[model samples]
Target: MTKTTPQTNRRIVLASRPTGAPTADNFRLEEVAVPALEEGQLLLRGQWLSLDPYMRGRMSDAPSYAPPVEIGGVMTGGVVSRVEASRHPEFKEGDLVMAYTGWQEYAVSDGTGVNKLPAGFAHPSHALGVLGMPGYTAYAGLIDIGQPRPGETVVVAAATGAVGSLVGQIAKLRGCHVVGIAGGAQKCEAAVKELGFDACIDHRAADFPEQLKAACPRGIDVYFENVGGAVLDAVFPLLNIHARVPVCGLIAHYNGGTLATDSAAILRRTLTQRMRVQGFIIFDYYVNRPDLHAAFQQEVGNWLKQGKLHYREDVVQGLENAPEAFMGLLQGKNFGKLVVKLD
Candidate 1:
């Protein structure tokens, strides 16, 4: 039986675009009546909402791979939601699904891109973090582009973060020495002690570059680039000949103005070292290849079941807090994968 739909739905919409770091003023909360579902539509009650660095790009009206979220529009996000009413053949009431339902408490989907949760799923929220996009980003970028080898040194920035955490773990599984770069002591410690990295360098330290160089004495074989800026500059000299770099997120420069890298130096090094710096957008993998998705789910799912993988979520309560929580993510204030719990 289907549950009765709520008369009004709470939502957070983009109030304004920010010049640099976004603030609470950039968002607006509103209440509106939930629209009646059509014959092929299903009502989704959002449960867990993901807050990622990529959302920063979506908030802006800049040119990018995906279109920016329009002003007065609901902020874009991946959500774990429950079906309240289903007029669609492939869905039913009480079904939990993963969908891009944005920052709203309720949504109507025509079943496009909605995925049913696996039976006996222990943590549905993991779908927004480790088991979902972030995990796949780490897997696809590291394995396919980075191509880490046994006994080689692999480095990743934002060490305790959603993607970097998985990148380090998978590198470790491949028998590679993993070095992680994080903002502070706590995150660095978590990366080394909990996430099992060979060494975790504190990017906040005065001698961060020196520390990173020391950690990777053999030079970096594969550099999983997440947070760019000074971190990329530091990793540049340490990159080994013919090293592979999987360019993923650039969170460090996402909020503030772009950080200028020495192009001349990069060109000289590119020629002399023959390093492969390939930029990848996770969406490409989702579209170009489907097998990679299946491989990641099966392998990472098995690892999770066997206690070979660990995940952490920094869950913020309430839909109203989404704006503030998102701001904190850009500041690196959230300890792990930032998620919002509506219920």
Candidate 2:
């Protein structure tokens, strides 16, 4: 009997689920055999794997927009990878592409839903950050529903994060007075001074609600909800009549706890105030996205080139750290977009 030699493939799988905040023990790293390429498929060596708050929804056993990750299964994520071998006609060895390759050092894909990255792109890892899913989410959610306008007051929480940062910048471009809410002093400073937000308040402050209220004395015309627990509480009373809210993420509640019961009252206020509030998953808007996505990418890409749109990345080296790094995301420990690098 012949034994097959295992090729290099490292994976991080769900070890166990947390009742609340996830910990290192929730993920188990294991060695697996590199997959053989099949027809129209390519073997990818992951370059960068994005760690996002949405992954927390997948970890829980409760129902959500996406299914929960089964215990002992590999955690799912978007990845930037280089083609190591290809049986597909369109891809070749060394071609860099973006895919949903999850938390692994190796993956195999049949080229469907893959974007061939532009050659000489300075940061291939960017496919998981500013130019990628998070960016698109901010673009679509804010535009299709929120419709941020000139001279309006825009308030967004998680202001230093991937989606929230772009939301602030795009709103600023519309001539809005943008106020950002972040977790700490350092992040608040960067949100205002670095990203050009009109003002930023630290949610960690002892009197955060008052500070946020002070920053938006004119009341909020648009509320981009990113961290939707206490921060929502602060922003609620400040929402102006006919305000628009585009609900994208609720990172503060990702740990499986419900917010205070009074949160339901905000919907009543929405009805009485005639506000337009909508919750959305970006992927839902992709079918009608070409026009907006192109416009957003062009403008945002230019801003990036001109040193206007700023992005911060919390990079942790190796696939091995994905579990711990993801734990940090749920706890707001990540200062910006989090990505894990693997050779």
Candidate 3:
């Protein structure tokens, strides 16, 4: 099938660094002429763009595991695209691929760091969610770092989200009692009913800490840390001896929030409990452990196929709506893995 080359590429670029939460003003949309592909290059048309909490950190110039998105540059993100045209030997036109092509309608790539989607893959969008980065984050963080054992109590924050949902369900499959902490009652319900969490607490409730403690009568053996402000404050006291805390993200503090003041107490507890509080970036695993990624693809992919795992996406339509959707994501407004379906 012949594909028509796109003349213009529409992209969202960073206009200015955000102080607190990002607003629509921080992003500027531009339509520019598509550049011709050179040798060993591919022209990609983005179909789906992922919006994640980590992008909030990239919006700031603060010291982080990854570099900040430069001013006037396209906001950094992973995209699932189709190869509209290719001069690259390894890729061909009409192949679906996953790449870090940012928030754009079209991109030119030299095929570096690009992974072709398996032919006839049922859900291509899953490459951006369950079968992709978020899925790996949950798998590695929970299995490798958290190391949940049978009958242990595991608590996951942001429980209905892409990572947390998988974390909780995986814990259940491993024979652990999984408790989830989510924002509202509806999400809390979904965490238990849809995601198969043993119990889910609403962090927005006034008695949230009490409820979390009540839910975990055996004490938390593993805490998958995602939203780490008030949730951390509540979970800290209930951690069992030798508990493992895999700190994947701190979304509550992403928008220039205050640091926790009770560091001394935290250290004291860590010392007494012999807790393993480790932080990890998924990129490190990708570089060091390709085997784990393969194992994840096999195991999780099977679970999905057998209808043992669940995944969700809160999709937004159009490139023009991405900024507003992203802003909503940081505020816990999105119900699941947020993605933009580019028009």
Candidate 4:
């Protein structure tokens, strides 16, 4: 295959920090000449870009685990790219790789953080979803932190989403009764039917809390905390003694929301119940436990092949539409793992 090199690279950069929810105005698209690659470097043409809730935190200059994106820097993201050209000894042209190439059409890399996609991999985009970071996050957080046992009840918020879907499925495989909390009738239905969750409650219902309680007759032994705010409020009272809560994300509170005011009550309940609530970032596990990643790849990869796991992607076409699609994601408009297919 003859790979064509583009002269110009189009990228989306942070125009300004957002006050509340991010808008299209917060991102600016600009085209610039692709830089010439030096020796020991490679040029990448992006095929897919991942848009996740964590990106919202990076857009702000607030204190966080990772540094915020600079005013004029390309918005940070993970990309699956094809090596259009390479002068590096380790990598070759025509190789498919996963890299932190941000929101750009083209990138130059020294291969520091690039991982070559395994040959004959059926889906390259799955490297950004189920078989990648999100899948690992679901597996490690639930199995290691949540530690669900047989016949226990597990409740997952954002049930049909990228991480939550896998969390629920993995819990079921461990012999637990899985209940999911999702928005709207359609998502709730899919959670139960498609994802094999025992029961799914629609959070938009007026009696959502009541429905969640009804679904979990044995009380929640493991609560996979994906959406905070109202969902957290509903799950808090139902946590059984010695319940485990793996806090993977707080998507509801990501867009400058008010802090929960009932901390005293929460602490009191935690004391009485002897609950275990731990927050985790996937990057930590990558650094400290390479073995877990290997296990995840083997176990989850096998489950996927055996038709025991389900994955979904809410793909948006064109780089120009990424800003609007991202804004919609914050509002719960995206139905699955959000990714952009670069033109």
Candidate 3: global Cα-lDDT?
0.93
Local accuracy of candidate 1 as per-residue lDDT tens digits, 1-343: 4556689999999999998899889999999999989899999999999999999999998899999999999999999999989999999989999999899999999999999999988899999888899999999999999999999999999888899999999999999999999989999999988999999999889999999999999999999998889999899989999999999988988987555567898888978999999999999999986899999999999998898987888989999999988988888888889999987
Candidate 1: residue pairs that collide: none
- Cα displacement (angstroms), candidate 1, residue 216, comes to 0.6
The C-alpha RMSD in Å for every predicted model, in order, reads: 1.2, 2.8, 1.3, 1.4
Predicted candidate 4 versus true structure: per-residue lDDT over 1-343, tens digit per residue: 3755579999999999998899888999999999887999999999999988899999999999999999999999999999989989999888999999999999999999999998777889999999999999999999999999999999998888889999999999999999999889999999999999999999999999899999999999999998888899999999999999999999989986653539998899889999999999999999999999999999998999899998889999989999999998888888889899995
The per-model lDDT (C-alpha) reads: 0.92, 0.86, 0.93, 0.92
lDDT of 1 at 300: 94
Candidate 3 Cα outliers beyond 4 Å, as residue runs? 1-4, 259-261
| Cα displacement (Å) at residue 157, model 4 | 1.0
Residue-level lDDT tens digits of model 3 in 116-230: 9987689889999999999999999998999999999999998989899999999999999999999899999999899999999999999999999999999999999998888
Candidate 3 clash pair list: none
Cα deviation of 145, candidate 3, in Å: 0.7
Q: Which stretches of candidate 1 lie over 4 Å from their true place?
A: 1-3, 258-260
Residue 258 lDDT in model 4? 50
Instruction: Report the Cα lDDT for residue 63, model 1.
Output: 96
Which regions of candidate 4 fall more than 4 Å away from where they truly are? 1-4, 259-261
For candidate 1, report its TM-score: 0.98
TM-score of 4: 0.98
